[model samples]
Target: MERKRHHEEASSESDDENYVPYVPLKERRKNEILKVTKKLGRAGRLLQEEEKKESTDDGGMQDEEEEIQVGPNANMSLLDQHSELIKKAEAKKESAREKLLKEEERILESVAENKALMGVAELAKGIQYQDPIKTGWTPPRAILAMPKERHQRMRKKMEILVEGEDIPPLCITFKEMKFPHIILKALKKRGIEKPTPIQMQGIPVVLMGRDMIGIAFTGSGKTLVFALPIIMFCLEQEKRLPFVKNEGPYGLIVCPSRELAKQTTEIINFFSRHLVEDGYPALKCLMCIGGMAIKEQLDMIKQGVHIIVATPGRLMDMLEKKMVNLDICRYLCLDEADRMIDMGFEEDVRTIFSYFKGQRQTLLFSATMPKKIQNFARSALVKPVTVNVGRAGAASLNVTQEVEFVKNEARMVYLLECLQKTPPPVLIFAEKKQDVDAIHEYLLLKGVEAAATHGSKDQEERSWAVDQFRKGAKDVLVATDVASKGLDFPDIQHVINYDMPEDIENYVHRIGRTGRSANRGVATTFISKACDESTLLDLKYLLIEAKQKVPPFLAQLEAESEKYLEIGGEVGCSYCGGLGHRITDCPRLEAVQNKAAQNIGRKDYLASNAADW
Candidate 1:
């Protein structure tokens, strides 16, 4: 039995050596195709059975039965092999197509990004930073400084008495008498003898310790209107009680911007310069605005300031920190009330109001008092004297309205043309920071002197830019709403609305930057057919309501705005432009790197990247 088993095993081993396993590639391919075919056949048979039961009422079911046959009698292995090869070829083709599509998308994005960078660089090349000269009319300084020659001319044109009528000693309250004679003398030297309309109307009321509301246009001397009375009253209190009272100032002047606060403080200083010079109880002024260290302001207060000029947010911060005490605050002056509201400072205003006592005298001033402002007035002032200077809507009347219809694509070209044609020391306003930057860049590239002022810029940068604008080194300032109010550019011959304002009140505030101090000024607004209802409303508000003439071209453009809206579609690119590109695109992509490098050579990226990196 062992011998037999051994022989069988040997035979099996020899048979295995002689035999080769056949792997028919074609048959295997065919079998795979057949397996798929069999699945399809089985599925078809099941479907036929279902239809035979369902279509007992349909003649189409009978026809389907005749066409369907269930059997393995037919073998088309060759056809199956061919079909399998075809399927493989089709899958390869699809894969290639998908890869090609992905590559194309990537290339298109790269090209678009490069193109955007080039465009930004081109715009940046146009900037001409004109060095500031002390002799020239800088935008704000031209207006604020009020050159001696122009001042003399204005005094001549207007019936301004260099030596104003003196108030009766009785009419001049004890508070008024307490003011350092130096401040009064400075007012006399500046040819500001009599209080202007705002001063005359608002001052006596404020001194009487009443809450008053003064609505007036820019450069109507609103600062002195509220300031003088507050100072006088505080000085009277100081003199009446002597050093027994530790409290310093009873007056608080709240401005909306750092520039406005600074400008207002300067004006106040000028008025009180005599006191400081004479050394008789110097009128100490403290300025509190954002971008400065709070500790510095606190330190100044610690040294005992006589008057407070502050922005809302920082003041509120100080109040919270116990760095300031408003318990003794007897007077409040809100300069540029409209601007404060427009800046979304309503809550801050309310918060500050809560800190002051109810007995304090409140004086509010603004160029335009819309319904919201009127409501604020109702809440703030108690049965206040509402003084409307000029007309409620006539703020822009002092500013001449000129409108230009330009295509969206040709905005830069037309902007350059306008700048070239405009007189020196023009102020240009854009709706958005991006537009401000763009316009600033375009102007620079075209050899036009320009700079921009917006919230994005640091405090020092903004101050420098405004100073340059004020010095006439930069002939034009491309700015946002940040420059709309609280800015006094005295010699601005023209205000160019490179982009129309979003709100009518903003329009009044913007163009009002010019036409200051009874100086005739022209305002040119670039309106595209695609501007929104708000833009149109602002134009109409200026024309019909404000009594400014509507340019013939703006009327035409307004009529055709529907088509423009369809083309531009919206205010900003919802995806790409709104937040610096859409979701699919990485926000971290390199910006127009060389744009800022050529002009400033500081390698500043487009500000949108500031958020990302």
Candidate 2:
């Protein structure tokens, strides 16, 4: 009020009809002289007081009043000081009736734009995150008061670690997490009896409304960690304040792969059905991914939507077309976040971030978080709690890893014997689409029910293959690395890598397909001369870390890696998350950096643009 009153008073003089600029330079100079005289008078008095005090307190001082006020360009030794002072005196004074905060200050407060004019530009306006909610609903005192040592012991037992400031405690069970009755019932219906390591800690942190980075081995039920909470969140919001037409999607789940997006949407649909059954408001969740008709998705949003699970490309396209708006969207979860970056979706992800209307609760779930992804997380999410189950990029301990030296020609024959060792429902991962098709054909000729998925397969075919495998209709699913990231298949007895993956991270994800949901499984990897020594060395160290037996061929590499291993300790290669090699020797890191450079290089058409006449 005081500032406003002063501003109004000062502006009143200028608001008068007689207000005008000074006609002569002499008139402005007179006013500036008055102001400068007052300023210098005050400075001279203060300096005199200090000089007097010093002389009285100590010995007599000959020199006094040393400080002097001068114009910015008034250098003591320069001859132009007199002219600079004259120029300064003729300058215009700033307005006294200024805005409280400049444009830059408003942005710092998250007020990127001024309030819109009502009835003019207000239609479909977004909720500004001027004062975003930093913390979620308060948890029970017991959860908040858990002892640090008890938290540590629980995490150690589960082989999980939660690191951040003001981290919420983990829940022992689904009920302990204080989920709604609908959620509890849905969990029971899905047979999710207890929380996995990632779920235990991740659910609590996200439910508390904090941003999170969840890193667990693949097949550790990372889907439910975000799925259940998002269901509860959407349900609560609808019951409290329902969404109207064209006005929602309070929750979002982003997947790198379209198949994973479909899977997550299915889970949400199931829970949404449960919510409706319990007489809750209908929570609309949309799978806003590509390979589907955009018109149908637009139709769904016209009614209302509470959640969306989408891939980067499709989501970005929708945002660009103005078909979808993130005006009220919150609670974003990035599943297989590291894979998203690995697949070159970082820019799309950032572009998607620009559409967000307000600050939101973001969750990142991945099997591996290399340094590149870690840096992305730091920029995208708020202060986030990182809940890691087992080591990042570590192969699951539940899978018994077996590496064999099979010549290129002998792998096909050995694969038959390897399959015979395990029962039905085995997963085989090949690096190439052609290899996947060939393996599927060979398995079918042997009277084995099998399916294949790859980039060449359309969305429907890919989904059908996964469903057939999940339902036990097919005993085997041969796929490229597409299936290795975030697809959930239950009760697989064995996994075989038809050939070694190019990188160690892909190797971990391949075997991770089987040993999921606390089930013991086997992973057999066949390597020939085609496989390089670097990946083999990484595999050897990985097997040793998981306590798997080392083959005779890999024993030599193990001895070689021991010296580097001892130096690395628990801090392995922070760049690519490889165990045997440091960042200096990492192959994937070199490739990604080279690709990044290439992305910024000139296009072919631009090369011949010089003096084309």
Candidate 3:
């Protein structure tokens, strides 16, 4: 029995020895099959090659036979060989297809193992808030879409300068001001015999070397108020110094924004054109603003500038670089001072002021002078003439003001309703960056061609937004306070305050956006119960004093809102820490529902019937 057991164990050990480190029998069989298949492929190719050689021989024979007698035998041989070649080519193509499929599968497996999809998920997180359809969805096309005819008509309207019958408060007589005979002749050529209230008051005050503060609404010829005096001063000073080809600027005009600076410079250039008729070359004017090449501006400054119109930031930058010499800047003017503070550029204004030393005549003009500005005036102006042209912070008499109460969540919806109910080309103001973006998206979804401008946007974007709003490319512009000052968009029949402004003066500035140039306009304020409604009362009182009829609906709402605060008292907004509604819930915000309503039927309706070339 022991011998038999030992023999069985020996057989087991032999089996283990045979299996150790050797290829499995099943794998060996698969290798043999692959070898056989490869051999078959080689053989098939060889056979195909032989068939081609035979076909060539048959073709030669057929050509030779054609020279004598036509025969079907060569033709049948050629057909059979061609059929065989096609079969082989198709088989090779299938093999290549299979190889490509395998390679694709391997790549997919590798990607899966690496978890590449995780990276995409991470990327999506950054823009999730702005993904319209997923979050309160609004279509982008709807917001930017516009009716073609409306845009065309709006573009046709020109922003006329100084045209009205109120006998511009500052009309000038030929005797009061001392202009060279040449300037007087040029003024006559343009048919401008008298200056507006602003020009009349501002020109002489600026000329007298006294720091002056002129408060006037836009379209009151404010540009000319500063321009005429500066130009006349420069011209007069230039004539005094003979053989002075390169005299420093006799006047400097600083604006809050680039748009205002450009507009002011254009107005100066327009008035200076008459210099050609005066037997003198064109007046040397330099325009310096951000977004333009600094080197070019430096070169211009080096070449010498007679008059410089610039934004506070760029001008300060140039001054720091020693590119601009302020030693000869005897005359200084700050246009749109209120706007500079609103844009957080108060420090820049202070910096620019630092460059000036004793005996410089500083002229500061604003639509409404806030306390900060008052302090600036106290320090900057030297016992100057303070002329308040219009009622301080009162809406224009021609502007009819209205207020609507809406729920905090429904502001966007109310905005669209107001816009649809009102005329085309309405301007909407939003108080926050996110609110402006949200309103812009809602407007686009409503099928209203609209754009927004804010401090967060770059110069090009801001300018494009403003241009689109002005040219009627976009009928509505949702902007922050940047548009509140020095922005003149003609044909804007309505101005909607999506959020009530915190300050009463800002309310006036907001409404001043419309009812401009003696044209009739409407200013609507959207207020929610959560917002401070006292601004409405302040606005109503101011309008009443201005002789404008107050809308009864707003008056009733204002009376009811008085209960929220003590009589003759002010309640501050806890959210914005300001007196009006929380800045976050600014009355300037339009409701989303309002936006959706405008978007309806917009997708199918073409902006214009005119065929696009």
Candidate 4:
């Protein structure tokens, strides 16, 4: 029994030597951390020694010893890579922060520049409210599914210039734009096989409920850009819930000229016709112009209108008279904005805006955006996308320009010769109304079929003359810049500038009468000593830029003006659209500045003499 107990005790002693005690998780973690801390300290010391050895003057023996020590800590090598990565990331972040600061400073500088020009600026750095229309928009599922690079390529191929963030995908085809079947049918009936560049970018953008400023070559189908989208917009509204009597006119198109209002109405009517034929709601479009019976337009308004196309004069008249209500109107378009602003219609536009009851999508379409338009857009438009199809003040490539140095006294005799350059169905533009009448008389006396129209003429006479010219009843039409602004005359193979226009922008529009719809045409301008040096210089630049032949007169003018063209030779004035002159000497800009100064002087004088009042 004694031997058995001794053996058992020895077994218990063996078990005690192998036994491990239970530990709480917290205590175990603390013990593990302490052990790791010790290991790290040892590793740190060893690493320091290794680095020191690497830098020491000692040779083979010490280098080998350092390598041996580093090899034992191979598992911890990721620490070096991890630290380097952290440094790189920190550097990238710092660079990004610097760039952001630079951009902010640039924005502030731009704001200061605007303050110098207009004396108006956003007062403080505040939260800019994003337009709900923009925030609310989402791309169609199919459009979203497209490869982003495809849209980039489309813009490149189409030569579409866009400046905005997150612009909508461009549509290559009308079908791709997702136009309604009926509207597509109307497009097919009109024989429009493809969408123009402006239409491609403008349609999706406007349809997405964003503001836009579109600049494209004349006759590049700008009207359709807004026209089609407006139709689609109204149709969607009507289909959701039919417009009650006098409750609609959900869209409005404002034009600078009565003729443009009439033409735009025709286009709207052309497309809206499909809606009714295919069992959709009747989309009524009214033409409100100066000559039209206001009572008749009012009566049509009473019957309920979905769209109204009007000129500034008549539209402003009705709005002020309470004959129209824009309570439901959410879309507004300014066609030929440059001419409209030139006619002093901008003030009227401001007045008309007072009548609008809510946020509206504003669109300004022009070949050239003037300084006033730029200021107005900055104040009014909320993140408007500027879609310029070509460069500023660019003319169509399809027009072959011919510049002739003809004396003023000899120009009349050369008129018949110029007309002979191209066939009938030609358009002639003169700088003055009297010049138009004189040219018309000369053409008739010469027994050439011709018609004449100008601003002073009644709308009926002008309409008849334009109708006669379009229907082939008259072979030629002679007019001032009035007829040249946004008038479409088919088969117009030739354009004659009997006198160079006072403004280069007008000259662009006058020549744009030809070279339309992919049809090549010719423009002949008669330059003489009567022309201003500014006009002549601008003409020289236009010819050279167009790659046309510059007569000796213009070449000499260019050489003489080389001093002025030394700076900003490649670009023209954005404020005036004059290629020959810089902004510092731009007559229009100078005149505006002087006028503003006078106004300010008058205000100061009034304030100083307040007691007199």
lDDT of each: 0.63, 0.78, 0.64, 0.78
Q: Lowest-lDDT window of 10 residues in candidate 1?
A: 129-138
Q: What's the alpha carbon RMSD for model 3?
A: 31.5
Instruction: Count the clashes in each prediction.
Output: 15, 0, 28, 1
| TM value for model 4 | 0.76
Candidate 4 clashing pairs, residues 3+ apart or interchain: 249-305
Runs with alpha carbons beyond 4 Å of true place in candidate 2: 1-136, 558-562, 566-570, 596-613
- For model 4, how does the per-residue alpha-carbon lDDT over 1-613 read when each residue is reduced to its tens digit? 9999999999999999999999976467557756765788977567656655675767657545544554544545688868877999989866864664455345334432342111112223232336726423345678779997988888888899888767888877788777778888888887788988989898888878888889888888989988988888887788888887778678889988777788889888988888789987778999999876688998899988989999888988888788889899888888887678677775677677667666778888987665445555655566778888876667788899988989998998998898888888888888788988988998899999999998899999988998888899999898888777777765888999988888899999889889988889999999888888887888888888888888888788753334445332336554577888755456666677688799999999999899688
The TM-score obtained by model 1 is 0.60
- Cα deviation of 92, candidate 4, in Å: 36
- What is the Å distance of residue 246 in model 1 from its true position? 8.1
Root-mean-square deviation per candidate: 22.7, 22.8, 31.5, 19.9
User: Per-residue lDDT of 500-544 in model 2, one digit per residue for the tens?
Assistant: 998898998889888888888999999888887878888888888
Top model number, lDDT: 4
- Model 2 pairs in collision: none
Query: Cα miss at 17, model 4 (Å)?
Result: 99
Off by over 4 Å in 4: 1-129, 132-140, 370-372, 559-570, 594-613
What TM-score would each prediction reach against the true structure? 0.60, 0.76, 0.58, 0.76
